[model samples]
Target: MLKIYKTKLDEEKKLLEDELGTLGQVDKKGDWEATPDDKMVTQEVQDEGDMADRSEDYEERSIKLNFLELRLADINRALEKMNGGNYGICEVCKKKIEMDRLEVNPAARTCKEHMDKVV
Candidate 1:
């Protein structure tokens, strides 16, 4: 069961990293930020209207990159726990997390009883 969960989470982490890499590169702190792909566009757009459009596109990419980064963090955390022998333990209650819940979300940090709790 743990092997299966780890495989799935590892696959997901790789996929998320690949998706995030398309939008941005990793910083020194390991955080991903959207890299503006429009250096030429910035140079060409002298008008305020064109500048605004470029900014909007950059903002959308930034948001998507941030979301992917968060997911990657969760997946990495789960992997770390797996290595530390605490993979299936709930963060809030410190109990063994339900296998069914782990099956659905291997990155879960809380048990089913504390599902409403936020970290």
Candidate 2:
């Protein structure tokens, strides 16, 4: 039953890691730090418009990195639960999570009833 979920989780983890690698660098603590997409910000003589574009690109990359990191965390947690024999169990209600919800998100930590209430 968990084989499919495990496979999906592994695939997603790889893809997210790859995407995150392009957008940022992983710190020594294993946390991803967002970096500017435009590597041409080296010289100190940048114009206002150029600086603005670089700043905007960095903000975009930061936002994307954050989202991807969150998803990766969820996938890791789900995989851990699977290893612990607790996968598909809602963290909130402790009920069996719906298959439909699992289908939609293999990393889901809650059932459809408590999806929005999850922290």
Candidate 3:
């Protein structure tokens, strides 16, 4: 069971990192930052419309990158827990998390009963 979850998490981590790579890059601080469009950056902004378009695109990518980063963080945390020999334990109750819930969300931090509190 643990192996299955770890494999799933490893696959998901790769996929998420690949998806994130398309929209942004890791900065010096090891955090993801949205990259501006190459064309927009190289060419001069001729009008307000062009500027707005670039801004909108950057904002959209930034928002998406932020969401992907959060998911990646959770996956990383879960993997760390797995390595620490406490992968399926609930953070809130200090009990073994339900297998069904772990199946649904391998990175779940709390049991079904205490899920809301963490959320």
Tens digit of lDDT per residue, candidate 3, span 21-105? 9999999999999998887766567677888989999999999999999999999999999999999888988999999999999
C-alpha TM-scores of all predictions: 0.90, 0.93, 0.94
Error of 2 at 98 (Å): 0.7
Using alpha carbons, what is the TM-score of model 3? 0.94
Cα lDDT of model 1 by residue, 35-113, tens digit: 8755636556767777777788889999999888887888889999999998988888899999899899989888999
Output the TM-score of candidate 1.
0.90
Q: After superposition, how far is residue 105 of candidate 3 from its true place, in Å?
A: 0.9
lDDT at 24, model 2: 95
Error of 3 at 92 (Å): 0.8
lDDT of each: 0.86, 0.90, 0.92
Model 2: per-residue Cα lDDT at residue 100: 88
Rank by lDDT, highest first. Answer: 3, 2, 1
Candidate that would win on TM-score: 3
